[model samples]
Target: MKIAIIGCGNMGLAFARAFLKFDLVKKEDFLLVEKGEDRMEKLSSFQPGVITGVIGPQIGTYDLIILSVKPQDFPSVQEALRAVITPNQVVLSIMAGVTIANIQTVLDHKAVIRAMPNTPAMLGMGITAYTASPEVDMTQLRKVENLINATGRSVFLEEEEQLNAVTALSGSGPAYFFYVVKAMIEAGKKMGFEESVAALLVKQTMLGSFHLINTADKSLDELIKAVASKGGTTEAALKQFEAGNLDETLIGGILAAQMRSKELSKG
Candidate 1:
């Protein structure tokens, strides 16, 4: 499929690299529109696609167009995009807080798909949640799904509103995981381990725990029970977490993120 990506930032390049790595789109068939001179120079470092400084009528020829610019930059992009975009072409937007309905309305076009993807997509281990307008047919949906899967895994939501929940949960999830890991490492350092040693220990433990979560037949509660034997050290940590309402705090923070996402979407 002929694909055009309007921005060449990290997330955009992540998708571009994945598509090229998987042979999903040829370098010749791919087009990159980036306005930054330095970014354009950097784009030349790797042969991802045909690079251009601006969007033009040539954009109309592509089967799919990916909008990866910042939410605030869409107005300028929309004016140019709307003029040349054909009705049959599909637009996939990865810009945060930008809704599919708004894209369709702004461009006076249909068949728009909006997706929320995390930073892990750079490593091809990301999870993306997407929603599409009714005008996107089954074939186009499947094609877009296949392209998204190249970055990792993807889920299609029937309601676009759910993307905000996804944005809160998975899109911003890595930072939460990192925060917990940092705390664990700090605790290890207080107990006498060097910073590097503490980091290695905590990182390995987290990695192993993740593998167990995937491979073990036990439920999360059961797994916690297995580690926190009655009156053990794990039980002490669990008690402290409960006392501080850590779980509730984490949930509240995610809800706040969703609320803010909703607020941004309205603007």
Candidate 2:
């Protein structure tokens, strides 16, 4: 199928690379649009066979259009393609806070799908949560799933409202993990290890813990209990975290993100 991707920025490039890697779409069948000359040059050098151009009349010919532009840039993009987008074409958007209704209103098209994808997509290890407009058919939805799954995994939501929560959780979740790892590395350094060594230790520990959680049959709580024995160091740290209300604070922060996402959708 012919697919066109607008905005060849980091996330856009990630999707392109993932799609190409999985053979979901052929390079020759894909169109990469970027306004910046330098970026267009870079994309062309990376995939010479792929069609590259600035946004123009040619976008109307594609069966699918993937909107990867920034949320703030949507208005201009909408205006540019509003006259060309047909109801038969499916529009898949990855811009955070740009709701399905917003796209339909702005672009005057109903077959839209809004998705929340994380930075892990860059490595083809991300999870995406998506919801589609009622006008989208099952075949189009399945195609979107296949394209998104090439990045890693994808889930469909019946209600579009859940996308705000997904945006808060997985969409911004990578930064949360990195923040904790930063603290761990700092703690290790304070305990007398060199910076590089502390980083290595913390990174490996985090990776190993993630692997264990994924492969182990036990629930998360069970694994936590296994690690934190009564009166042990892990228990001591857990107690400190509980006393400081760390979990509550983290949840509050995520909710705040969700609220911000909702507010942005209004714009």
Candidate 3:
């Protein structure tokens, strides 16, 4: 089936590359709708057979149209799509905060899907959470699932509103990890390691720690206990974290992210 990706930005090109990797769509069958000449030219070189241009009547030939534009660009994009959408098409959106209902109000397509794909998708190892309108057929749902899974994992949230929490968690979760890693690197450097050494150490610590969690059946608290032997270095750090209410501080930050997610819906 032919797939058209609107707004050929990072997420768009990443999705395109993943789809191409899995042979879900060939270069010729894909159309990239982008506004800038430079970006269009760049994507053309990446996949020569794919077509790139502003959305128009000629581009309405796609069976599935994926929206990858930013939220603020939606109004003008809606105007552009109003006349071009046909019932023969399905719409998949990766734009945050803009709901499936909002998309329907603009593009007027019954088969709409909204997905939350995070930053790590650039490396094809991100996680995406998505849900679709009831109008979407099983085949279309599977196709979209495959598309989201092309990069990494996919979670199907039964209730559409759960996307707000998904956005709060996974969507913003990477930045949180980066914040911790940055602090760890700085701490290492302050302790006498060079910048490069600190980075290597912190990166592997974060990576290895997560890998252990993924492999182990132990609870996080149990894992902490395992690392913190009676009066060891890990215990000292844990004591400091407890004294500073680190867990409560973390919860507050996550709650702030959730609130921001809801706030974006108002925009």
Candidate 4:
């Protein structure tokens, strides 16, 4: 399919790289519209697609157009996009908190899909949740889903509102994972391990645990019980965590993020 990407930033480029890597779209069939001189120059090194500095009538020719611009930058590009966007063409947006209704209204076009993909998409290991307007047909939706899956995996939500929860859970999930890793590393340092050594230990443990979670035919509770043996070191740490209400705190923080996402969507 012919695809056009409006922004070439990290997430945008991540999609571009994944599409190319999976042979989903040929370099010739891809078009990149980026305004920054340095970014445009940098894009040349990768040569992912036909690069241009401005949105033009030619954009209407593509089968699918991806809007990956910042939420604040939508107004700057909307007018230009509206002028050339065709009704039959599908527009997929990855901008955080930008609703499908808003995109369809602003662009004066239908068949819009909005998706939330995290930073891990840059490494082709992300999980994305997406939703589409009623105007988007089954074929178009599936095609978009296939494209999104190139980054890792994707789930389609029936209601756009669910995306706010997804934003809090998986969208901001990597940072939470990093936060825990950092705390563990700090605790190791306090226990007399060097910073690098601590990082190595914690990272490897996390990695192995992740693989176990995926491969082992065990529930999360079962896995936890296996590690936190009765009155063991892991159990002691888990007890401290429970005393601190860490699980509740984490849930509260994610809920706060979801609330903020809703507020942004309203604007």
Best-performing candidate as measured by TM-score: 1
Candidate 3 per-residue C-alpha lDDT over 184-204 given as tens digits, one digit per residue, 9 for 90 to 100: 999999999999999999999
Worst 10 residues of 4 by lDDT: 226-235
Q: What is the lDDT of every predicted structure here?
A: 0.93, 0.89, 0.86, 0.94
Off by over 4 Å in 3: 48-51
Error of 4 at 247 (Å): 0.7
Per residue, candidate 1 scores C-alpha lDDT tens digits across 174-218 of: 889999999999999999999999999999999999999999999
Models 1 onward score TM values of: 0.95, 0.94, 0.94, 0.94
Lowest summed-lDDT stretch of 10 residues in model 1?
94-103
* Steric clashes per prediction: 0, 0, 0, 0
Q: Which segments of candidate 2 are over 4 A away from where they belong?
A: 48-53
Query: After superposing candidate 1, which stretches have Cα over 4 Å from the reference?
Result: none
After aligning candidate 4 to the native by TM-score, how far in Å is the CA of 136 from where it should be? 1.3
Model 3 clash pairs are none
65-123: candidate 2 lDDT, tens digit per residue = 99998899887687778987777899999988888988999898999999999989999
